[model samples]
Target: MPITEFLTRNATYFKNDVALVEINPEIKNIPHVTWREYSLIEAARGGAFRKQLTWGEFEKQANRFANLLLTRGIKKGDKVAILLMNCLDWLPIYFGILKAGAVAVPLNFRYTAEEIKYCLEKSDSDILVFGPEFIGRVEEIRDRIPRLKDCFYVGDECPSFADSYDKLLNYCSSQAPSVYITDEDDGAIYFSSGTTGFPKAILHAHAALVHSAKVEQAHHHQKKDDVFLCIPPLYHTGAKMHWFGSLISGGKAVLLRGVSPEWIIRTVSEERCTIVWLLVPWAQDILDAIESGRVNIDGYELSQWRLMHIGAQPVPPTLIKRWKAVFPHHAYDTNYGLSESIGPGCVHLGMENINKVGAIGIPGYGWQVKIVDENRKEVTDGVGELAVKGPGVMKCYYKDAKSTDEVLDDEGWLYTGDMAERDEDGFIYLVDRKKDVIITGGENIYPVQIEDFLRSNGSIKDVAVIGLPDQRLGEIAAAIIEVKEGFSLSEEEVNNFCLDLPRYKRPRRVIFAKVPRNPTGKIEKPVLRKIYCGESVVAQQNEINIK
Candidate 1:
C-alpha cells in the first residue's frame, strides 16, 4: 500500500488515458498540456506561465533533478522544501524528490519569511526550491537556516545566486536512480497554519497516500472518466489528497488558477468537470452568484457536473438547501476529516444522504468512530469528543512525540478535538469544535448551531461566534458578523433573527467586522479570544457553554 503504488498502478492501467489536463495561459488557457504516455507536458502563459513540461519530458527532467540532488550529496530521508505556488513545476519537483527517496516538505506560499524559516529549519531541509515571488522573503532568513545549501527557482529569470529550474529540467539525464523507499518512510511533512501558535509539522507516510485512493475514491464512487475541479490550494492535505484520488481513479484533475465565481463557472462548463470540491466560503460565493443573477450559468452546458463536495469546514444546512435548490440533479456532500487522519477518509455525507441534512453521514468504510466523554469512555448517544482509528490514521506529528502522544492514545484512537454526536443508526452530527465551544453560566454552547442560524439570514455574509470575557458569567457568547456588501443590517436585527434560539445560546454582544480564518476554513478562535481579552493574563472558568 505504498503511496507511489497508486500512481504506478494507474499508470499501468491507464497509460494512454489523459491523466492531467493543465490550463496553460500561453496556449490560450486551453487543455494544451496532457499527461499521457511517458510523462507530463509543460504549459506556460503570458509570462505568468513560463515553461511547459510533458510527462515524458517531465520524467526525464525529474530524473536529472533527482540525479542533481544525488550529486549534491543529498541522501534518502533527507528533507527538501518546495516553497512555490500551484504551477506546473511545483508538483513535478515534489515527485522528483520522492523519486530520489527524499521527503518533500511543501510550505505554504503565503507564509512570511519567519514562518518559512521555521518550517525549513524544523524539517531540517537542506535544499529550497522556490519561485521569484518569495526571493526577498527567502533572502531575509537565508543566513539563519543552516541546513539550506542550494536554492532553485521555477521562473525563467533566476537571480545570480540561485539556479533556474528550467536549466535543471533541460539537463540530459536518461538514467533513473534506483532508490528503495518503504511504506514506513516519511513522504511528506505538511505544516499547520501558525495562526494560534508555532505551526506543527504533520507527518504522513507513503502508505497514507495510497489510503486516499482506497478510501476516498472508493467511497465517493470516483471513476476513471470523472473530471475533478480543484479550487483549494494543493498545500492543504484535502486538495492534495483529492487530486491524488483523481489520479488513482484515472480521472482528470482540473486545477483552477484562482477561485472566482466566473472563473469557476467557466472552468466547470469548459472542462466538463464531473466532480467539484470547494470550501464553504467559496461555496457561499457560488450560491450568492446564482441567487443574485450576477453569473449567467443557465445557458452553460453544466449537465456534465455531477457531484459538488465541500470540506475544510462544517457545511451550513441552510447553504446545502440553497445549493440543492440551484442544481437539483447535482449531488452535494459534506465530508468531515482532519490533516492528522489524511483528509476526508473518516466520515462523509454522501449523495445518498440528500434527505439526511445536517449530519456528517456515517463512518467511512474501513474507519471506526466513537463519541467519548472527558474520561475517554465511549458515550452511547450524547455529544462528546470524536475519536477515530483506522488505516487512514497518520503515524504521528513529525518529531513531536509528546504532542502526538497527547492526542493519540495507547489504544490507537486519535482524539480529534471536535465535538460530535452519533445517532442510533450511526449518523454523525458535528456539533462544534471542542476548542470553539462557548461556556456561559456553566452550560455548553456549540457555536455551529448559532452560526448556522445566523447564516440562514440572507443579509449575513459570514458569521463566527466566540465567547467574550464577562466578569460575572466568566464568558458569554459574542457574535461577529460580516454583513453582505450593499446590505445593511442592524445589531438589533441580527440579534432579533436569533430569537428562535434559546436564551443561553443567544449572543450577549454582536460586532460587525471581518473575522479571520485559516486557509483550511477553521476559525482562529484564539485570535478572536485575544481581541476581547487584552494582552494581560486573566483568570476565567475552564469552559463555558453558549450553544
Candidate 2:
C-alpha cells in the first residue's frame, strides 16, 4: 500500500487520539492558540512553540495540503522538495506530497544555499516548501533553481514571492484528494549524509516506505497506546522511518525541540513514551548525564519507557552496558541501514540477542544481508562489504546512472560500502567503512576499532581516527580527540592507553580537539582529514609523534 494510507487508516480508526506532539519552551506563552495565531507568534518570536495534532487533525491537514498541491498543478511523479526542521508541519507536508501522488524530496535543514540549490536542481524539483529558518538561504538560491515553479513558506511570515502554508490549508478542503497513489509510485528523494563527498539523492518508491514502516513495527512491536519519542530531524530517514513504526501502528509520537538530557528524560516521563531511537552521541550523552548524577532517575516516571534503540553509527557495546545498569527494565536494540536502503532496520539487533551487543544482528524482516568480497562473491566467515537485498532498497540514485550502477547490482542487491564480518551464530559485526580503512606499511587498520578502544578511556569524551600521509609508510594513523570537560590527557597518556594494541594498528599521532560529526552522529572523517592534512598537502615525517 502507499504510505499515505497509513495516515488515512490511523485517522479513521483513532480520530480523537493524539498523533503528534511538538514540545518547545518558546510556545509556553501561547497555549491554545489557533494555527494562524501560532504562525504569527512564530514569525514574530521564531519557532519556540508547542503544538499537538490528533490523528483526525493530522489527516485533515495532510488532505488540505494535498488539495493545495493539486490546485497548484502538482500531479503524479512531480517533485516537491521539503526543507524544514522537526516540527508539526514536516510530516503533514510529507504525507500531503505523497497523497497528491508527488515525489517528496527532504533536504537537510543544515544545507547551505549552494547545497540546497544543488538538490533542487538535481532532483528536478518543481516546488519548494521551506520554513522561516531557511529563508535567508532560500532567498539566496531561489533564482538559481529554474525548474522550481512554486515556493511555499511554512512559518509565521510568508515572503512576497512565496505562498503561506497556513493560508493554503485554511482555504483548502479537509477532504482527501481523488488522486490514485499506488505503491509503485515515486515516494521520496532522501539525500545521503555526505561523509565522503557531495550527498547523493537516494530515490525510493512508495512500497519501500511502507516496507520500512512495516519492518520497524514488526521488530519494535508497537501498540496503539505506545508513544515514541523523536528528536532527530524528520528530513533524515533514520528519524522518520523509526517514527513510522509508531505511525503505522497508530501510536503517538513526541517530537522533542531540545537535545538536553534533562529535556529527553523529562519528556519520556511526562509523555510516557514507550519507544525512543537515539544516535550514538545522544545515547552517550544521556548515559554520562545519569552517571555523573546530574540527572536523577527517580525524579521522572519513566516506567512506561520500555524500548530504547540506537542507530546511525556503530553501537558501542560498552554504552549499552552502562544504559542497562540504570534502566534495567528497558529492552534495547540496534538498527542498521543506509539512505540507499531507505533507512534503518534492513538489519536489526533483536532484543533477544542483547548478548551479541556489538553485532548489528541478523537480517531484518523481509530483508536479506550477506558479506561479499571485492569480486562480488559472498564471504561466509571473513570481513567483506555488507550487501543488502530487500523491498526497502531504493530504485536508484536519482538522475545519476553511473553512481547507481556502482552500488546496485542487476540481482537487486545494494552493495553497502560498510565492511563487515559474520559470526558462527550469523550475527553481523561491522568492521568499518571499506574506504575508511587505514593502510600503514601494508597493514590494514580499522579506525572504528581504535576509536572504540580509546572511547573506553576515562579522559577521552569523543575521538575520531584518520589516516595521515607519511613519507616512509604511505599513510599513518592519527587520533583526533575531544577530552572530557575539565579533564586533561597528555600525549604520553594516550600512547600508554593503546600500548596493548599491536604497533601497526596503534595511532601514531594524537591531536586534542573536538571531533566533528554530521547531524546523524557519523564522524566527518573527510572533514577531519582536510583539517589535519590539507587537501593535497602531506604531513612531514617529523610530524609523526609516535614515541
Candidate 3:
C-alpha cells in the first residue's frame, strides 16, 4: 500500500496527461523571510528550468533515480535525504527514494548548514540530493559529516564534490527497481519546525502515507478534471498532503512559485485551477487586493474555481467572511493537524457546515477527536489539549523515545499541544497553543483570543500577542500590531479598540511592529518573545506553571 502505487497507476492510465506544472514567477516579488530565499530565486532563474512534467515523464524520472540509487549500493531501510525547493524534480526525487525501498527524508530549505548535518546524522542518512541553492551550505559541512557518503546535485554546472543528478538519471534505466515494500515499512521522516533551530524528526510508516491520500480524496472529493494550485514549500506536510488529493484522482496540479495576489490569480486563470490551498496570510492579501481595487475580480477566469481551503494556523473567521462575500459560489474549508499526524485532515471544517465558521470542525474521515485536561481526563465543556486518533498518526519521534512518550500515550491518541474547547453542538474551537498561554496574576490569557479581536479592525493588517515578564504580576500581555499600509494607527487607537475586552485580558502594552511568520504562516511568537522579553523568561514561567 505504498503511496508510489498511486503514481504508477496514474502513469498506466494517464500516460500523456499533464500531472504537474511548475509556474515560475521570475523577477516577481515572491515573499521571503530570509537571505537564503534570495539565493534560491537566483539559482532557479534563467531559461534552463524544466517547467512541466507529464504523468509518464514524472513516473519515469522517479524510476530512473531509483535505479541509480540501487546501482549505488543503497539497500532497503537506508535513509536518503532531499534538500530541494518546490520544482518539477522535487516530487520525482522524493518518490524515487521511496520506490527504491529507502526512507525519504525531506529537509527544510530554510535550514542552516549545522541543521542539515544534525538531521543527516540523526536520521543516519547515507545519500543527499540537493538543488543549487544549497551548494555553499553543503560544502561548508562536507568534511564535518562523515556519515554522508554521496551527494547529488539537481541543477546545472555540477560541482566536483557531488555527482550530477540529471546526468546520472540519463545513464540509469527507467524501469522500476526490484524492491518489496509493505504498508508497515517505514517510508518517510518529517521534521517539525523548531523555532529554536533544532528540529525533532517524526517517522511514519507507508500505511500513514497511503492513509493520507485516502483521507484527502474523501474529504475534498477531487476529480480527474480538477486542477490543484500549490503555493507553499513542499517540504512541509500541509502542502504535500493537500496535493495528495490530486494524486488519488489522477488529476492535474500547478506548483505556483509566488504568493503575490496578482501572480496567484493569473496562474489560476491561465491554468484553470479548480482547487486552491492557501495559507492564512496569502488569503488575507488576496482579499485586501480585491477590496482596494488593485485586483479586479472580473479580470480573471475564475468561474471554474470551486474550492479554496486553508491550513497551518488558526484561520481568522473574518478572513473567511470576506472571502465568501467576494466569491459566493466558492466552498471553503480549514484543516487542522500537525507533523505527528501526517500533515492535515485529521480534523477539518466541513463545507456543508458553513454556519460553523469559527470552529475547526469535527473528526475527519476515519479519525476521532477529543479534548483532555492536564490530568489526562476528558473535558467536555472546558478548554484542554486537543487529541486525535487516526491511521495518519506517526509511528514515533525518530530515535527519541522519551519525547514521544511525553505526548503520545498507550491508548493510541496523539496529544496535540493546541488547547481547544468543544462546544455544545460538538464542533471544536481552538483556543491557542498550550505553551503560548500567558499567566498574569494567576489568570490565564490565550493570545489567539486577543489576536482575533485585533484582526477585526480594518486599520490593523496583522497582529501577535506575547507575554513580557512583570515584577509583581509575574507576566503581562503585550500586543504587537502591524498597521495596514497608508493607514496610521496609534497606541491610543488600539487601546480604545480594546475597551470591549475584559480588563484582565486586554494587552498591558501596545507596540507597533511588523509581525514575523514562518514559511507556513504561523506567527513566530517565540521570536517575538525573544525580541520583547527573553524566551528563557517565558520558558521559566511555563515550567513554574507545570509545577
Per-prediction TM-score to the true structure, in the order listed: 0.76, 0.79, 0.78
Error (Å) of candidate 2 at residue 547 is: 24
lDDT score of model 3?
0.86
Alpha-carbon local distance difference test for all models: 0.74, 0.85, 0.86
Q: How many angstroms is residue 447 displaced in model 3 relative to the true structure, after the best TM-score fit?
A: 15
| Number of clashing residue pairs, candidate 3 | 0
- Rank the candidate models, highest lDDT first: 3, 2, 1
Q: Write down the RMSD of all candidates, one decimal each.
A: 11.4, 11.2, 12.1
- Candidate 3 TM-score over all chains jointly: 0.78
Query: How much is 24 displaced in model 1, in angstroms?
Result: 6.7
**438-489 per-residue lDDT for model 3 (tens digits):** 7564344678778988999999999999888663355689999999999999
Relative to the unseen true structure, what is the Cα RMSD of model 3? 12.1
Question: Model 1 segments beyond 4 Å from truth?
Answer: 9-16, 24-61, 172-175, 193-196, 436-547
Q: Looking at candidate 1, what is the lDDT of residue 309?
A: 85
